[model samples]
Target: MSKKKIKADSTIGLTLKTMVISPIALAYLVYSIFQSQIQSFDSISTSLLLIDSGIVTALQLLLFTKSAKKVSLTMLGILQYISPTISLIGGVFLYHEVLTNAHFIAFVFIWCALAVYTISSITKWRQEQMKNEINMEA
Candidate 1:
């Protein structure tokens, strides 16, 4: 399909998704306001926070859905690490927060696990593709 058509479809999908979800989200927000500790914030601050969070969430959802449509599921899963990786970098470099040995070890382990998982997934996909090709030939 043409890139223009894909872009239009993705935009429409995002709008529809937002429209369908907004009511449920608003209901939950109202429930939280009554049931949770929302009164701690004065009206102005609470309203600003609500608006900021809503905008951030909507942007994240839009970006995530658009990228997800364009990328393989495996790549999308791997991309989930970007936020944490950014946090890690920011803590170490920008904020000058100390990365303790345990945290460093944990970070290493997580990346190692992700690498192993990615390799295994790619191998499995390749094998499946080979099998499909063989079947097609037969």
Candidate 2:
């Protein structure tokens, strides 16, 4: 159960799922269109927007699957915070959104937790390195 093999297996599973699901999804969309449930794509912009979103979603899934193979589940869970953190920053700065006091407190807590987790991981890695060095010397 090498990492590469695991990644490949997961990728194959994803592809299989996509194969099984995409046709049904496409059929539903087509049915909706035939039933006049899908109203108007009055402009090229709307079609392009849908295409752009589909591309983004596909890329995100591909990258997530690839990275999941190389990282510990704990680290993966920690890294998942990045998307929400970025969204929060975008909302605050780009969209001029305000954070409540509770939101600020939560952000601080998240940062502190990340710091502690990082320090612990580094310390464990250092101890492992030291043991390897001693074993080599012996």
Candidate 3:
């Protein structure tokens, strides 16, 4: 097979692993939450937080895995990181979680990296589309 085909196959293999793991992780997360609640480490109100967290994780992973199948794992990893980073920022700013300079810097770096990736992907995609149009015209 050609080199491009081989490389594409590698990505396909990675995609399959991610697709399988995502649901498994989500299920395990929900099970752990329920188990903890049953163990009486908390009451109904506190348990509800765990249940809500599990539901949110399952849903987030469901959405993330979809995009992960399209993008490279490195990019997907950064995307995953950003969601929690944003959540942290929200907790800090809105709920006054004792924001720190170090934490703010960390989030800034994450945002910068994601911004770089997004810009590069957009440019590369536009170039590919233009190339395709040119080929069609040819």
Candidate 1 per-residue C-alpha lDDT over 35-127 given as tens digits, one digit per residue, 9 for 90 to 100: 875674568887788789979987887776676777866677788898999999999999999999999999999999999998999899899
Q: Which regions in candidate 2 have their CA more than 4 angstroms from the true location?
A: 1-10, 19-40
Best by lDDT: 2
The estimated TM-scores of all candidates read 0.57, 0.72, 0.51
TM-score between model 3 and native: 0.51
Clashes of 3: 0
| Model 2 Cα lDDT, one tens digit per residue, 32-108 | 88988976455788988987998888777877777788888777878889989999999999999999999999999
Report the number of the highest-TM-score candidate.
Answer: 2
